[model samples]
Target: MSSTPSTVLDRFLRYVQIDTQSDPNSTAQPSTEKQKDLSRLLVTELFEMGVLDAHLDEHGYVYATLPANTTKYNVPVICFCSHVDTSPDCSGAGVKPIVHTKWDGSDIVLPDDLSQVLRQSEHPDLTAQIGNDIVTASGATLLGADNKAGVAEIMDAVYFLINNPDIKHGTIKILFTPDEEIGRGTAKVDLEKLGAAFGYTIDGESVGTLEDETFSADAVKITISGVSTHPGFAKGKLENALKIAADVLATLPKDTLSPETTEDMEGFIHPTNIEGILEKVTLGFIIRDFTVAGLHEKETYLKRILENVLTNYPHSTAHFEVIEQYRNMKEVLDQHPQVSDYALEAIRRSGLTAKRRSIRGGTDGSRLSFMGLPCPNIFAGEHAFHSKLEWVSVQDMQKAVEVIVNLCQIWEEKA
Candidate 1:
């Protein structure tokens, strides 16, 4: 193995330049063809790094394995996973990454757009990265640091391990999935082929966060059908579906049970989309909570609101449908507490105070846990994800690489 440190920053810069934005409207597995561009590049880079088995599958998922260098035979195969596609909410094309060398704890205004500023007050994490190199986009596009930072950290860790065979570790699997932002990240994962005992999704924010739990989620779609009549003669005969939908939205508790009002373990009922006319209207909502009971309660409350709103428009008919998205990984991770315990130990070994936290949003790990791999989330330094104001610190990312290296050692030592 080479004694020199891996160039994780360079890898990350190169990855964000590629436009790998995922599309939610697309029915394809990857949701976008451009996602394959990064997937193919990852495969090529993996092969160049001496992982001969590294290849992108038909579904644009990149899978690679690092064979164990140790004499011990019982070490469990641990998988480090991340997604390649950026969120569909923001543009990820022609990303010009700006590096702020030695951040002085000041507001960073994007070069392309001064309106897009990274304020220290808004981002408390910036306080910790005072002297570190901060990376952000040029404001025209999103910096794909969400999972790309995770990908770079994992790649650098693998490269470090490969170059230094002295660091004894068991077989490690690397998985780069697609469409994580659109929520189909692990939909096509072949667990039989992965064959790992446990997994860690290096896809969280900040420096030392080790998230073992995520919100249990469900999608609610409300469709309203109303009688349409000519406006000239529509005094009492017309029941505007748009008016009913508006009333329902206005009745939703804005002071509580909302994404803007909730924090920590609090649940939220968020309306994602609303569209329709006087004849028909549809409302899309995403419900989140830490518990199944909480989810049901929120759904019941939402239905009650809709029912009350429809009472005014007796001629209108409404249909409310709930779709299951994903459950909290805590249900699975609780059964295997060692998965997070080892990660916390690894974080301390990497010289950071490990913070055991839960994600307000779900990761690919959430779905993978239910799929039988039992995965938890690890920090990759991504901050303000899914926006033009996104940023990450080079020092924080390097620390994450150290955490990954330490995790490999911890699992082997414990085994």
Candidate 2:
């Protein structure tokens, strides 16, 4: 391949430099107001690309439209969506994107932090990028390629469609959402305003991967109340809430049923937060599985763990509450098979073998699918996302751009 990079690479480099990390603890729709910075910029770029209706709303979502170019068939409107916000798991500020041109198969040591090294052994996808340009953060911060790469790819695809009007296509909608990392990507999304019959979130990892199945998710909050007493007078009378919470956690299976122990298709009970005093403590957990049955099974198992732990402390009481997060999109996607079939054909047209797989986590598409959009996830070439070791390849992004273009054309042709 030539050393020349595509416009998608430039767009990705430009977008990642802007810090848009979403805060999980915030109550705002976007969770972080700074996320709108990227949303606004995306709108500006979309307007510059001749997308007249491109605008950012108060909810930190950038919506735009590429009018239909084909008059032959009544093609259903489709959308290309991506999140602008990065994860709070790592610093997204001052992201110095280092593009290693024609990278050899070697470990990449990020300059800012010498200990932050990217090895092919750790990142299996690097083997395919033997001579391709690889992008990484300058240590101490994430690359923001998680969905910024998707954002740039969608931007370029829209730009391409506008420039090459001869490549006939139906009306295509563009959406740039915020706070996806904190699970609020579609919190304020106005689907009626978007008006897309189908959608694709270009936010998956690997070059040729397309994901339609996502984890059915639920959030569990456990509040433990314990008898608090004076330390000097405390004996058997003291039932510390912190100790009760610790006991429950300690009782969880050490070799299984955890994020650290789980692998492909395996669901896990992940403890996200734990906070409290000796009198009361709140433990937060997230349960994930492919099926709704499996999802509930995990939740039941968890409640059982809590019950067993509380039996030892007769004075202590616990409350377990389960909040529905999102369900497996595959349920809705299965009913609209054409959406994924068209995507697979498009991926094949992009000169790559389609690698269809299930996502271990959820995406905005998960909620959108049940919301009547039948959206699936497409690859954006992002890998090891939400961490300093995150990376993307220039060649892979260009291929993603091609896939987007082909997918739109496929929709037009099929219509």
What TM-score, computed on C-alpha atoms, does each candidate reach? 0.96, 0.95
Cα lDDT of all candidates, in order?
A: 0.93, 0.92
Question: What is residue 241's positional error in candidate 1, in angstroms?
Answer: 1.8
Q: Where does candidate 2 stray beyond 4 Å? A: 1-5, 231-236
Tens-digit lDDT track of model 2 for 319-372 = 999999999999999999999999999999888999999999999999999888
Query: Which 10-residue window in model 1 sums to the lowest lDDT?
Result: 1-10
For model 2, where is the 10-residue window of minimal lDDT?
1-10
Clashing pairs in 2: none
TM-score of 1: 0.96
Model 2 alpha-carbon miss at residue 174, Å: 0.4
- Candidate 1 residue 369 Cα shift, in angstroms, is 0.3
lDDT, model 2 = 0.92
